[model samples]
Target: MKYSYYALFTTNNQGRIEVTFPDLAPHVATFGNNLPDAQRMAADALVGYLLTAESLGIKLPQPSSFQDLTPDSQQRLIPIEVDTKSN
Candidate 1:
């Protein structure tokens, strides 16, 4: 919470977003076809990540930038598997 540790990004090539938390290891969530959805998912994911880390006795780090997660800027390709249930 001390740092602007959220990466908000939406790629035009595909309808999806990439959210990265620089503080926590393997802290990434991708499950959206757009920015808004991704942000929501990211928020939920972050809370869950923190809770899990706390239980595992891990200290979550805070980063001013997402440099650790990427070279210049970070981007992720999120594959969405849609399950359709119709009768």
Candidate 2:
């Protein structure tokens, strides 16, 4: 199954990119040194989160629409896609 979710990327004071899935658990987060790296990490995190939830039979919340999300100036809303079968 393929899942789509939004990742909130924010630049911290130390200049690192912090990524989080707002619709998911608050503890479900990842970070990287830069945008590209952060994006990769976000995808990996999303995949792991979904896989774990599936194995545990936990129901995940529906993804919020991109238009409905509001990211601040220091943050960006990015869409992430993951396929459980491929993983």
Candidate 3:
């Protein structure tokens, strides 16, 4: 199955892009140097989180709509896609 979740993308002080999933918790974050790299890392991070949650028998939360989130000036919302075909 493939899943997509909304993530917040922002730049760190050092200029690397950071991605954070708001609806899913035990809060995790990832970083990359550019938009595409950041997007790839975000998907990886979400996939890891879902696998870990599954292992612990925890339920994954539904993704929030883009309109529901309020991002700061530094943050933009992006979609992170995860494929669980092998899992």
Candidate 4:
């Protein structure tokens, strides 16, 4: 199965790109030194979250529409996709 979600990328005070999935949970977060790295980490984080939820027999939440998100200047909304079958 393929899962898609929007992640918020924010540059923290430490200059690291912090990634968070608002549609998921507050505890779901990842970080990287740069944009590219952050994107990769975001995808990995999303996959891990989804897989873990599946393994625990928990229902996943529906993703929010991109248009509905309002990101500030310090944050960017990015789409992340993961295929469980490939993992």
lDDT of 3 by residue, 18-82 (tens): 88889985466888999999998888888888888777898777889888889999898987878
CA lDDT scores, all candidates in order: 0.52, 0.92, 0.84, 0.92
Off by over 4 Å in 2: none
User: Lowest summed lDDT over 10 consecutive residues: which window, candidate 3?
Assistant: 22-31
Name the lDDT value of residue 53 in candidate 1.
Answer: 62
Per-model TM-score, in order, reads 0.57, 0.95, 0.87, 0.95
Q: Candidate 1 on 1-87: residue-level lDDT in tens?
A: 221345545454565665655444366554567766876676566666655666788775654443444434456523222111210
Estimate, for each residue in 1-87, the C-alpha lDDT of model 4 and write its tens digit: 899999999999999999999999685799999999999999998898888988999888899998888999989999999998899
**CA deviation > 4 Å runs, candidate 3:** none
**Can you tell me which runs of candidate 1 are displaced by over 4 Å?**
1-4, 65-87
- The RMSD of every model to the true structure, in order and in angstroms, is 9.9, 0.9, 1.5, 0.9
Runs in model 4 deviating more than 4 A are none
Q: Determine which window of 10 residues in candidate 2 has minimal summed lDDT.
A: 20-29
